[model samples]
Target: MNNRKYIMLDGKVIDKSITETEFVKADKNYLYDSFGKRYLDLRSGLWNTSLGYSDEIYFSVSKEFSRLMNKKLAYLDIHSFDCKLYDELSTNIISFVRNNMKKCIFTNSGSENTELALKIASAIYGKKLNVLAINNSYHGSFFGGMSVSGIDIDVNGRMGKAYEKVKFIDFPDDIISEESMLTWLEINLEQYDLFFIEPVLASAGVRIVSDNFVNEVLRLCKEKNTLTVFDEVATGFYRTGKPLFADRLKYKPDIICLSKGINNGISPFGSVCVSEGVLVRLEGKPIYHYSTQNGNLLSVSSANSVIKYYLKNGSLLEEKVGKIETQVKKVMKLYPNIVYRCVGAMLAIEVEKQDIMRLNTILKDLGILTYFYNQPTNGLTILPQFNINLDVLEKALRIILNKIS
Candidate 1:
């Protein structure tokens, strides 16, 4: 057994030393542990590896980094950067998300992106910082993010007290009438300066809100002059069969937060894309947030490659996600007792709490990886890579069904 003890894996139950022994290399859609056991990565490495491991993007990024090795610099002011490569990469990102969103602010992770968005909104509406977030939505794990997140399991004791200015509303449910949801929004519209939401509640077991509900919320926000922020960390970059889930919404949000699949899981990167109106609000003000690794050359290059790849191959990737959604629906039909919700390549199945643990163990034993969500109810969340082989996915589903059914 490995004797090293200064390591930790979040949400892991095994002893630290044992978990360390499982460390190994990853290639494509599989992970090989020290014992040479290959496991199918269904969670896509925390739902970030949309393009899978060891992809060409990684190789290209390596080459680019090598070329720029001597010139690599950190903590430089964004306003004074003169690197041509950096400019090209930034331009590519802005063009990739062309439309009302003309400006991009880079961050190192989804949590930071959320925090930045909040800060921008706060700056625009100083002293009027009342924020509204949906229940069951997860923004991130950082203090500011945890304050707005509905699922407090991760930050319960550690977060101290929730932000007093932030309020939570129940996420729209199928059981709730549209009239009721609209009424609630109308009542609370004038109280908040900003509204935050995840296009798809991925961490909350892939819960999807109806478009009507979202549109109405946006309309109310517009009327109240409250800025709306979409946490697209989990639903952006064609993960939802669209470039961004916000694209499907009739009413556009003022600010959009993106990460996770932004760089096809190749680098730790996140960005907040804002509309011209929102940008103008902060044009003369100093941005209150800054990180040492924000918009690093490596991350920028990887993001450029990932965005270029997606723009070129989006149609094929959409078809692949469509097939996976179809497969999930078919599986759901076979087991009426198991409730399921799916969108694009993401799926969530609800089961008994005990069954969640049992199925997770079985899936692990079968060399498949998945995430279990215990909040809002027990659920097995599945986020497979966009290009996952159908045969392998089918086999994994079969194994799950055989064991769960």
Candidate 2:
């Protein structure tokens, strides 16, 4: 037997001898393994597949792009020249965000977008750079992302001393009053070149920060003339029942890092949507960054379809999520031991740390897959597809509640 495992799971190489179940097919919201057993993927492809597997919009878009590629009509390299798909994608993304996003820079993934945003920030600041981020927040895996990330920055001392300028402050908490938060920012925001934040800290057990706190952060950044970047990679594209979680904010972010649902997980694609101010500052900056797959035509086409799908069905989907939230709250009242939070289609139910693994395994055996974590909070996170069937979700919830009860 070959001892070499060619794949890494969760940043560690897995033992090759340990066979894993393979998902051979997918339905609306369920994945089918080779044994023909089906499991509901409540995490929605790591919260990227908002429309779910086998969605008609996704299928149609994919088919169209495949045909175009076969005809050799849509091959485009971002480094070369812009194409019609690029123009349309930019227009739709700008309108979808419906904020101060004046320009869009395409990238390969969320990590790449984070790195590019930091590069742009570095260009604006030129040499001396200080970044302030909230504790328990995750940006991505890139060096710049890891630096700004409040969590996992010092994992095994891997980040090194290259990002000493990046600092972290406590996320807004009950113990830390609003006054204290403002005072700290008022005195220190000026020294920082950029402030990175996630409206909802997905990796931190789906913790949603208060709107007032986010707005205050923006106000202080504005007052101090510091750039604010909203890391919306996980919370963007109608995740919080809004176009972007930033939509709920009082002030617009200078730069918005977007990915995940941008293309409905159809491709490795992401984008940095910049405000007019940030765009102006980026002009003439010798920030040389390029990727052959940055503006792939197929990704652009899929993104266009995703934007259209949201525009057409966003209201109905949001209504469904609202009903689901209400239903879950009612059930949660019965279980005092469980602490849970729901924002739109996203949900987090915290349980005892000791029970984390047991519950996750039980759920998996019962044919329900969710995102689970034991850090910051021990809980199971459920992010159902926006177009998920309510009755199906109700059944799944019942099973989960019964098992926990």
Candidate 3:
């Protein structure tokens, strides 16, 4: 495919932009420029390119679904074989998912899953839409997700004081002390309808909640009649060393969000796994929250495949990621001034820099993708896929260390 207006116009982007080695063809896991240099994808290109490019199996499933989907939306639902595929995928996924979370509602993106979850929580629970979120969390750029998100100063106005309905909590970097959560709950947790969390806060820099603190939060929330919601958009799939972060944490959120990995089936698939209890509350409701492109045959087919691959052969990936974490710790020791975190395969290394741009420019050219010092981390992250090879990861880390040093 030709470039998306990026090639014809050279030197156009001026915002410390991300330019590929070439402006030419877009392929799976591989981007080729007019010059023909191949860049190994380190960041999964927006962190969603699992199963990599040139995944023929994924395309095959899409083609099979398209033969059935090249019709009207109405026909695509009732008369389409896609429904059976959806049922089968969802059914197969449940055994892999938590037992309390037994139902799923499909959506277009993780943000949609967040929105739908919040909406359902309020509709099913009550009009009080107050949700508690840790500071510096990244749910999404959209409003509902943004509203509950701890990302401060959202320029898009996706979040505002309009979302005062939401509450903010300090995510504990250490074991969330019972003393801390109980203290927090005493000051807050009132009229709080739901507690939303990323078991391992990724965007805030791979900070894992202390097991004791996490269990205490659940206990306190249940004691206080607060519902728990896990936003696993980034951590889902095999990214977190498990299919979902909650899987490792073993907590059944009233609503468990899924995206980014759902449709490694083809492209762009996301959804939510609603608990049986949440579903019970949502029954008999006249909520029309479905999206047309949602549950698309192509994406669902790919999502099913990704899930199968993980459930069947992802243990090896987990072992590799565990090693990557260990290696990262050893490397971080060389940079004592750098504050860092690595948990469940998500990682961040924060450096107090006088000029951040210099650091980013050096790393970007090295084929390592990362965000700037956004929030609390003041450092970016290394969020590779579960199946990402160890050598590929080590090369990136070493390159980063060399540049920083």
Candidate 4:
């Protein structure tokens, strides 16, 4: 009946043509219906928007870029403020990753970064074309990302069959066990060009693998010359309490995928941190994967500012999550059946198995929104923004658990 509703339906039809995922009502940290019912942005823009809702730096930078373009915007190809901003952002990015990660390449979304990382791996090691991704991890919605995404509950039947070149290994969980994972890695990683994974499984309900296990995998990847890319789209920019939760684990990746928080949710730009091994050959011949909007000056400038903010408040970000982690585990212990998965800033509440969908719907009515995740582990993800007020967060969690019971 409403034009906005009609447009939303049409847009979904269009987007669904490309991918099976759809969106709910969202503008900033809040999503509203056509009727204008506001919902607390519990999921934080599908795990982006670390700063959440009307980020001042994004607005400020966007206004400046908009005003500059109003005067005389040069060809993005020609280079101007846009190019300078990207250079600065790259420098800021590389400084951290370079010391540990090695190199960086820009992309338009996490999926692009994932695909590009795979491409880089293929370009570097043609003999080992297979890329490994952890079972139950979510990277992106694109075909490449979907192919590597082992998140679907019935992916094999739904996606027809995974691409032969990409292998999905059962990522470690309480049930899977570390010894089983290491044996699996030892057997499969030798012939892989790239092995993609999340340091802490996010969509599959934030199950964290131990740092010791992660470092061992990295060692194996290095020995096999497999490019290991840690998909850090959710974990980056303080969501996981550190730039790379790998740092928390003391394991370094050859490539680390980043997005979501890159521009603080003002704009979208994704990047893959490349290691020295991959960058050394870039000068030999040009690698030609480019997006029209890749590293646009406006987004890059916003990203640089966002990183600056993260640097200043990084400790606080971790501290908040750290406190929440300790508190939730304590609270959850009081109600273990209701809260199932726990790792870092993300956690999942499991009510009666039959009541999962009802629990999700009821929580949305209670103002906290979460998604049905059937990957790596079948559970919902509670990825609140890094800056979500502690009181509001605890209240939300209480609401969520109470609604379920």
Candidate 5:
């Protein structure tokens, strides 16, 4: 009975009044609606807009892209004609993250990259193997990703469960002691062909994985010849005020999946970085894992610019994020009734009677936009641009506290 005049979403024509938040334009730090009402973007476009809406990098990349197109020097696809920029960007990314990764394969999104990482692991092992993923973790939206995700997804009253080979284990929690968890992992580690982890567990209320757990997992996986894939899709590219959350660990992961902040939310881009051993294993094999726009010039140019920006100014961003973290800590101290977790540029705020959807709407009405996480905990994650105005953010935090407290 419902027919939308123009747009069709989710296979149905939904009512227009369902959501009021509309964005017509955006600039550094804020999005402006049609009525010219500006809302500070706190989720950073799902934690990808690390460089904000507008920046010199964007302008420069656009100009470069235009010039390349005009000269017919820009090939849209990586497979068309090997572009040197592809390898250049990949090298720089590997260098920038400072991880001992060997090479990267470009993809269009985090989901694609994560799925691709899984494929790579399967291909290298040359068999169908079990996948071990932490409970409450989110890899991506693809079928392979959905299968391993900790949060149960249901479609038409049927649970969209993980693959038969996928197994879920509890993250180190109050009920599951770290020692017991380690013991369990030690006993059952070898059964898995791949072990997936989100360094910060961004979707799981910004839950940070402890060093001991990560180190133990890495050691066990290494001993078992299982590939440890770090799904840094959300925690990568300085979102955690560090180039990568994996860097803080005692050992390196076998593979690292990256996206989001690489292009500062300008282009659809992602890269799956693997260690030297993986690259060698698949060197001569026929690997069927590439899309037409896998290494499109638009994404490559934007990634190049973003990588360059971070290389030149990572320290400044770290300093700014440190200050913001301090301010948030102060706010948390003032409101002892609420719960909060902050690491680098990501912060989560929750209350006893948490209704994240309602709180999200309240924030939108208050001219502050954010995204909420559901599962294990209901909370709002404050993921602002690295260059967001400190005063504006401080005020917004107080406003959020006023509602929750």
Candidate 6:
């Protein structure tokens, strides 16, 4: 066997011989490898393709790109050019998030959007760089994003020294009291300039924080002048049974970082939705961040199409997600040893530590793609498209249950 010529860096040393060939085609909620094996994409292409593999988003974006081919517009310098596409896209994005946020800044990835939010907070509160993040939560993989992330990833090497500025707090587990949490924040709140959160900790075993906890945290942050930034990169765009998980909270964040499902996974794009108060602070500030693909025409158009799609069919999507959640809960009841949690289309199933690898391999062999969490407890995360076929999901679930049992 000639050693595989490609040098792919996935941070894992898997047996290349057992790996399947490259995927040749992707239809709705499924992928076909070169050998013609069909696999249900339960992870929704890293939880970004809320509308599944093939949708009208592809057609709309292609049509727009064909009309405006090769139009390059950078975020910092686009003001000089008459970029009507940029303006139209920005307006559409603002409309989607404007109920809780006032302005939007585009980026190419979730990490960049998160990093930009941190920079904006720093710019607003100079000299107060302390940030509060929850343990076991994940924001992204970039420097700023990793700094805020509480996962045990190997980020403390030479490049990870920047994470020293971030202080992590324990996530409110079941036994922790609200009063205790409030007291802890009251004592330590003034020292931090920003508090980053994932409304539903999707990467952290799909843990959903209580509304009371979220409301109290926002209240304390307000009292101490600490800016709140919701990293909704994983939970936005109907992933959590709402347009944004923050919609369920009583308090609105100063900044909300969104990505993943914005363009239904058609493009790599992210955005930071800022409140009017934060925008005022950034109004006259000189540019501190720039990316070549920031507000790119194709990405913007795709994102616009996704938002419009959601606006039109949001109610139906939400209803379908509710049905899926009910099905998941019922299946979970069949196995007492198995523990699970779900929010809209996202689900996390926990099994014994020893069986983690075996279960993952079995699920993969059964033609289901899933994600695993980096936690002490073995957790498999599933985030299917909002409108995933219930029949397909039910079949996959039965297969998973049978293997685990």
Clash count, one per candidate: 0, 0, 5, 2, 0, 0
Please report, in order, the local distance difference test score of every candidate based on alpha carbons: 0.78, 0.81, 0.67, 0.69, 0.81, 0.78
Question: What TM-score does model 4 achieve against the real structure?
Answer: 0.85
| Model 3: per-residue Cα lDDT over 1-405, one tens digit each | 354544432224432234534447545444555667555555555567644564554565656566666653323442334477778778767766764788777677877887787777778665667778877777776667777777653542532643557777777655445477668786677668888887776666676666666666776776787888878787776676666666655345677888875655256777778777777777897675766677566666667766766677667767766776776777778777667777656677775663455676666665455555456746666665545566667777777766655
Superposing all C-alpha atoms, what RMSD in Å does each candidate have to the true structure?
2.7, 2.2, 4.4, 4.2, 2.5, 2.7
Write the residue-wise lDDT of candidate 5 on 238-302 in tens digits: 77767888877788898898889988878898988888888888776656787988877878888
- The weakest ten consecutive residues by lDDT in model 2 span 12-21
TM-score of each: 0.91, 0.94, 0.84, 0.85, 0.93, 0.92
**How many pairs of residues collide in model 6?**
0
For model 2 the local lDDT of residue 344 reads 77
True-vs-predicted CA distance for residue 384, candidate 2, Å: 0.9
In model 2, the clashing pairs are: none
Instruction: Give a tens-digit lDDT track for model 2, residues 227-291.
Output: 99998888887778778888788888999999999888888889899999987887888797898
Model 3's TM-score against the true structure: 0.84
Best by TM-score: 2
Of 1 and 2, which scores higher on lDDT? 2
Tens-place lDDT per residue, model 1, 279-322, is 88887776678776785777877787787777778788778888
Q: Which parts of model 2 are misplaced by more than 4 Å?
A: 1-5, 15-19, 353-355
What tens-digit string does per-residue lDDT give for candidate 6 at 327-393? 8877778777877888788898876644666677778777888877756467788988766778778
Clashing residue pairs in candidate 4 are 103-274, 136-376
User: Which parts of model 4 are misplaced by more than 4 Å?
Assistant: 1-37, 70-75, 78-82, 96-99, 152-163, 281-286
The runs of at least 3 residues in candidate 3 whose Cα sits more than 4 Å from the true structure, single-residue gaps closed, are 1-17, 20-31, 54-75, 78-82, 153-163, 176-178
Models sorted by TM-score, best on top: 2, 5, 6, 1, 4, 3
The better candidate by TM-score, 2 or 3, is 2
